[model samples]
Target: MDLHYLDATPTEAERAAVDALLGSPEGGNGLDPGTVHGHGDAHNGGHPNGSGPFPAHGAAHGNGSAHGNGTRDGRDMLLPALHAVHDRIGWISQGALNHICRQLSVPPADAYGVASFYALFALRPRPSRVLHVCTDLACKANGSSELCDRLEQSFGPAGTAVDGMTWQHSPCLGACERAPAALAFEAGDPARTQLLAPAGTDEIEESARSGPADADREPPARESVPQAGDPELRLLHRVGVVDPDSLDDYRAHGGYIALRNALRAGPAEVIKQVTDAKLMGRGGAAFPTGRKWDSTASQPVRPHYLVCNADESEPGTFKDRILMEGDPFSVIESMTIAGFATGCAKGYLYIRGEYPRATRRLANAIAQARERGFLGRSIMGHEGVDFDIEIRRGAGAYICGEETALFNSIEGYRGEPRSKPPLPVEEGLFGKPTVVNNVETLVNVPLILIEGGEAYARIGTERSTGTRLFCLSGTVARPGLYEVPFGTTLRELLDLAGGVPEERTLRAVLLGGAAGGFVRPGELDLPLTMEGAQEAGTTLGSGVVLVFDDTVNLPAMLLRIASFFRDESCGQCVPCRVGTVRQEEALQRMAGGKAPPDGDDLALLREVGQVMRDSSICGLGQTAWNAVESAIDRLGTLSKGGPA
Candidate 1:
């Protein structure tokens, strides 16, 4: 096949950025030895999970499917090259994109399509210092709209450059615990990013102009882990107690002990322990971890891959972010254990782009682990245990949280979901047998291996064994990540978090997330276990326990949730793309009292939602209507769109 060339010429800076990542043109060959930023073993046959041999000083997705090539050479670097140009300049220009295309052997138009896919990447010209203020659910409940209004009053409307500074509304930054958050990203020689929570209009303005220099630091990792320092705490015990940056502290405090245990037990025994524990995935899917590992281990294919789904983009759900931010080393150690047990030599840690601090900490942790002989070829002492981890960053897309979509994103394609049949276990992350697990799920592996599987199983219920992490935000008094046994009731968890804030009466709780259903305050005794929630018509989706008070606007909250799905739908499937838009429109019409000409927007919404639920390719479409339907059924009539 012939590759068409773009006539555009890149700027010197653009050329430099591309060259820095892919290396110089090299006699016009457009290929080189430079990679897309990783510590070691950047090669994955079917995809680029940060293990490809192409070495670069840095980091970023994409149109089309896996292209024809010797596995994935220059093709996988498409996302990273785009990141190079975008990070150097605030956006991806035609010239920069063309340069990247020539280097990667991908068509220029396809490259542009991929660049335009992510919510974070800028295809149009934009300021280097961009302030992304959260206007999604949790933030809105905390007066985020008021902050936006104030910023507009001070500066112009969002997106308009004001003396080289600009601001824009963003979805959840996974900092719902510290509602009304904003993240500042300044692009330059060495790009800098900072998170601002409890964002004051004045503080936002200052951070906007001052850049990341005086940007207010986010709440310490411990703030997110409210139950930190507790002896009974399993996953979060070390979050606030130890220095996250110190390797020695991680060791002295019992880190890597699980890895040692796994090594002694061997891969088969590791699988047995996890299976005995009956550990289900903490990701919304709730699949069995041991089964996933066993299937991958049993695959006859060589070079099995491991992908840590650290990209938690679900609204009102942020347990993964807190875990990575607080305990970076633990993530690495867990991935290492996962790789060792699954017969995989390479691991990909795909973190969300919005988490600047977590990214930095995990990157540091990966480098330190590699340098300390914990990662790479050979074991800490045992040989033939070659395993290494590479960090992959997701550029603003909620759907990438889906497992297949994550593989596509890592493979340098559009972050769109692939139809299942050949699941990640059989053909994933480069069409090879792969094992995928979320941060919270993988972190549980060490615990399971350390404690005997049967003993661990007894900790929780018969089916849903072990502790679960719930991201408590919104009207809760002490909003943070809380850990409790699966059988704990919603009432007990709320009491642990000090119940509702300011003595306000609880109206309802959003279990799971936008993709999960709602429960009325009267149902406080419902257990948090998967079986219990399912029996009540909801799943423990991502462990989101977002509380709402009597003062909250249920209709408006539903509208926001609808808007989020509409904005995030990949448009790969018509039901989801069209249904999401229709859902939002119907709510808006009802909100403004302009009900459809048929005078039955509720009926239209139900139809559209059902179509999406049945026909959509991924869970985003399937569960898009969950919260809204739950609100109408459990809360009350929303036909008038009260206060929306």
Candidate 2:
């Protein structure tokens, strides 16, 4: 890599702003003085034990400065520095990258690698404003392609800046309820990032032409789902009924009571209750939540870590976003209880970068909780027990949803998954024993503790206990988030979502998101439980049920799904990197009438898929071919002569 390209330097004002945000003087490096290092002493740079295999990924170091204080080194500031430079100047100039690398002691090549990994960071010079339009499956069904075409007609082709703005098609923005979502990012004021759902040409044009002030206009109100007051709702009980911003309202609706009970019962009892409940993780893995907590607690390592995986980027899955934006306090309370049970004093909530509303609500909730003593030193006045949480935002990397990759992102590295064996529970975040649970998994903690594990277990099936959040999207009469038990049949779920529209027959259903397989309409009676889905050669991944009607172009949709995996693969390993590209090319050939009808492309696809699954490093590669494979085998996607 050439070093000269990274010679761009940050302006004096940009350096000052970053220093002020980090609370350090010029050229300072290390954590700020008195910054809590959980169970370890702050002077030791947060890692009491020696550095792990990848020290630069998570190790915190202190530099000998005149101030003699521990200021976070350049590695720790990678994300913040990127944000500062991008905010101060429209795009990350080579000068800015060089300046950031110099400040953090990061090599320019390594720094450039990290910067280019995320979708938000722009290495080359770009227009001050950028419009990221969603063209994923959910949005595509809702005319996102037409929206993109219209924008291109008005603002020129994708990636071209018209009147100082660039528009580009993007992956899922996690806002399926209000489909056709677009995010407007303006330079100079990062806080004013605007989300436009049902984004029209006029709205996007106005946003791009005007400055940040116009971009800050309130988004159109989303239509409310009909199931809010269904009485059976657990996770979403408070979503639409209560004011999301009002803490008093949340407390009034029996919030924090679970935390109080957990505190009274102590950590051991809390873990026991969870174990008894047999609660499975809702983030598709279905791992026993209690066992994960128990294993992390049993670790001999000091200063254990707890991570809340709120990076909900799975296409057509918006359940976590609904919970976070609606009941932010519950997430905070749940993380606190998780911290106590796992003997973790420090927690990190990694939310998706696209979820502006959820991010705001969570940040507000954390601040409010800290003020009320629910967080910070001696949480809720439990002397000698300290628990705190820090929110880390993801910079548009889908692979970061993986636990190890998320930890790496928090440690200021490229969001790529690490090899398993020293799994997260063994040697996870910061090279310590850590428990990483998704938002839905952590949200269940308080409920299990309050109702007693057995009582909670009675709500659902024996294996998949308790209620699950199902995201219903695509060509359905009522497409929204639905709360249902694990044993609920796919047919019943569709009925709850009001089924397909009048006169429309269901063609097929994608049981999960892109990483999940498909089930034909005939299998509607199949139970939506984990066991049933597996038996059907599919998965109830993230509880996403995307309904496809007779009018849908199945071949095109499968091709789009293939394209998504190809674009999002982190490219760390050969199987996934090359396999995804090969899979996409084969799918494109078949979809474009280029493949012979002798079934060679489909066979090649299956072979490539299996290789990726068997040899890939992470789940992203393993499941990349899921939707396409399922569509071809189960739904006759390619047999129907390409695109309808």
Candidate 3:
């Protein structure tokens, strides 16, 4: 979409590659019957003259070359593989990469390397609920830093000692239009202590500034810090101070104390602590951390692996980056405890390449932890329980966040997802059982190890108990992150995120990451819970909440998404490869204000989006239509509206 000024001066091979990628009879929506559900060639209906533009410098992906697309295979294979996969599996998951490898006679590692090299595959099991929080530079500048502060204030301390709650920060959840936003939250209970808010303080000064109508309004939200028997006062008590600046400050106030306590409790007690915490992965999937630890622990496995998935590429989500940069030790401690619980000797933190600052901080933290005897062999003087932490940096591929592909990348292979039946927990990283958790999920470990489970279960609603961290961004005075109970209403989050900027009409909101659907303005009052979001026909994927004022152009945004998918795609599956191209073409026509009034372009865009949604081989191609579909549902209002 950004290449229009280049004058279409593609080389003969480039032209041919583009043409082949588009194929003949391209008028129809790219969805075909072959893609509903099966395994087949990913390049069936593409160029027959062979993929034309194979970049010779494959090493660039590894060397972090600026020009490198960070793709694993030759660029030619990317298109074919995407087309082929689209033709077979309506949507791609971890399993498709293995099938592609089998058909291509490439090692699963090679295929996975390619898949992971791009940011489009969903390698991990889809969580029951997903949350995405934005932490882009713009968002950060607009108070994502403070938003992260609010979230940590609310969830950081509680998550560690409590059983049923957790939270983490990600980097650049990709909703650039909306800054300081997050997505996703499951059900959970609330703690009885007011550890976060000042006594009798109904609203924090900064939180008040973020609110609308109440811009000049201030009221006592709590009354006299109700007596010990006052349940209402307890539920309102969030667990931490507002924006306490340094990690050392966090330590002085009581950070890593849980880890120390867990170490004292020993592995069994530590495992029991987590089991009691009821903490679940906060990166969309709600797998119980303790349950995962329990399973990995009892299996009598050797070389069990633990991977901290810091590849937060989900659009509209970026909470992990904040945790890495602001609270690195929290995650580090969690990883160490996870190793202890699962008996793993080594663990890797797979961080995305986009955040250089976070990378440096994590490296520094690792060094600090080691020097303190908390990371290397015999951590904290625990005999026979040694674990070392290694940080693996991804070369700018969103799909590498997928556990399998991440594993492949760590092994020095291309980044592509692998098929699953035998999940990473049973057979992962180097063919050993592995427990991969999100940053927020890991951060909850030390807390759970310090507290009992029954107490943790009391926070949120059953089946979704615990607190959640939400990044709030969009047309608002104060956009940022907030940590609240699971059942908090969207209205409250909006108020906390600094209600929409004055003079802007709340047109629509995109919940979760790009994979989530949209919600109209009228739906703003919906509860900010996983089930509530689902009831609105969208998911809380990555806990990113993006607000669109009336001025946004939906079609342009759709085009942007199409271009993003097309560019970021590893080109392994047909539906995504070709379908994204087709969608982009249609969107280009619409964006250029040249679309015909007959509705042909609109129809084509819709058709292609539908096809890609139903036929891509991985989550990237599959969910690419989320934004498009949401926009279409809004009937041109989300876009500039030139045609149809």
Candidate 4:
């Protein structure tokens, strides 16, 4: 709640949408039964008109601090409210924005800022339905371009609606296993969304012309777990073996046994086990999970918080999505363990919006967990251990993957990374000690507690303990989630996936992701361990291994990667905001040129990349140049015939 910025009067439909989410104003906050809120007296130069400045008024809210005169602030609901409006109406209207402001005690300008920050929430009016086709790395390697061409011939263009629906290119939908994917999101009561993987033009047309019911539904996440029932598969043992929707199925497979073990052992023992296990985060940072839990638990602060970072938006990474959709109970149980170990009473599972199936399964799991007393007060019949998880959906900003930026997004601000040092463990989520772990990292906790730290530690290299989930996509014969020990070499993993199709020879492997590096075919012997990757001047970042055949247009892929960075940059800091744009421009110039790429363009790329790496606030900016640099240096890409 800031100064009076609500100038426009909301339509009945707009007001109803906000009201549905925030509750009616009748007898409480906002307008009277007959009078509209913010509809100042006509004599005072304010009415329910779309124009005319709002008249000044005293604080109407009951709580106050950093914001305006109001004592009440519903700013945390900003993202959800914007979502409500967008889901009800295809786009966010000025009136609807102002209405949400009044309901949430937020300023109109601030609401507008938050609304425009997300790619999913359109400020202007749009069709009620949207078809998001993936033109990303894995999809491109598949037949995504041809799919787009087919879509173009059927529909007018990507954005223009043929009837009441339209399709547009999207970044990775975290369905990398199913390349050439398309997601349809329709707005209205009981809004519908469907995934169209291996999206044939006919399916897209049918879904667009009629409804998602006419198209094939996405396969269960469990189906994507290639090594599901393998006794050796620690992370994915129950993925396809157990029913995702059943708590009984999860328990029969040994779910919550870790929580019971954890409760009996106490938080201290749990931390010690994780420490001895030497488990690291799977969220690209590879930070020691034990150290993070220890620091947060040791903090003098009260009411510690745990955030399950499930917003997996990395261009070629989708392991977390698979895990959440497959063994959702494990993620929940792990988050519970984390909350208990860290003394956190509340945990937030910040998930991505595109993961509808995962979201649904997680929500169901949370409800079942709460109902069975596995998540509420006195968990497992123990005294005074209270913890619950709330799911937060990210609208579509890659930067929110950064812990601080995620904090900001949850707090209802634009998704942008904040400066560190008062790091997240020290001051996070409402400025408290917080332990944040991604889905894969948290799911491993159950294994550590059950297997004993020493045994879990022995699964992989002594340095990088336990198994790793690699998202093997692109030209590989089998493109899916593969779990292997850390010491496994790239060649071994490729072989495990059956290598590229017999006709297509491997050109290179894009390890990590857009922010990761590229490896030449000869480098396949490199061990798939963190230390191994670092020693080789690259990283196993988030376990993304996107393979490409020699037939792909590699430079175009580089340009697409460049465009992803440029589009996703929050533009809060100059280094990433400007560097990403310049990088894309340089790639376009060099790739578009008929002559050989000049050394000047390559040099310029390096210079800009260095500046971004050195000055960018978050990892997104710091590693923006990583993949491009790897392509240039290792694969000799972006040159005479680059990225091929």
Go through the candidates in order and give each one's C-alpha lDDT: 0.83, 0.77, 0.55, 0.81
Model 1: lDDT equals 0.83
Question: What is the Cα-based TM-score of model 3?
Answer: 0.63
Candidate 4 lDDT over 323-381, as tens digits, reads: 88888999999999999999988788899888877877887788788879898678888
Is candidate 1 or 3 superior in TM-score?
A: 1
Candidate topping lDDT: 1
Instruction: For residues 357-405, write the lDDT of model 2, one tens digit per residue.
Output: 6777777787678778887677778897777776667778999999888
Clashes of each: 14, 10, 95, 6
Ten residues in sequence with the least summed lDDT for candidate 4: 47-56
lDDT order of candidates, top first: 1, 4, 2, 3
Pairs in clash, predicted candidate 4: 62-71, 63-71, 63-72, 64-71, 637-643, 638-642
Runs in model 4 lying further than 4 Å from the true structure: 29-72, 214-216, 594-596, 640-644
Task: For model 1, give the 10-residue run with minimal summed lDDT.
Answer: 43-52
Q: Model 1, residue 142: displacement in angstroms?
A: 0.4
* lDDT, model 1, position 42: 38
Off by over 4 Å in 1: 27-29, 32-70, 214-216, 596-599, 640-644
Q: What is the TM-score (0 to 1) of candidate 1?
A: 0.94
Candidate 3: where are CA atoms >4 Å away?
1-250, 264-276, 590-607, 634-644
Ten-residue region with minimum lDDT total, candidate 3: 190-199
By the TM-score metric, which is better: model 2 or model 4? 4
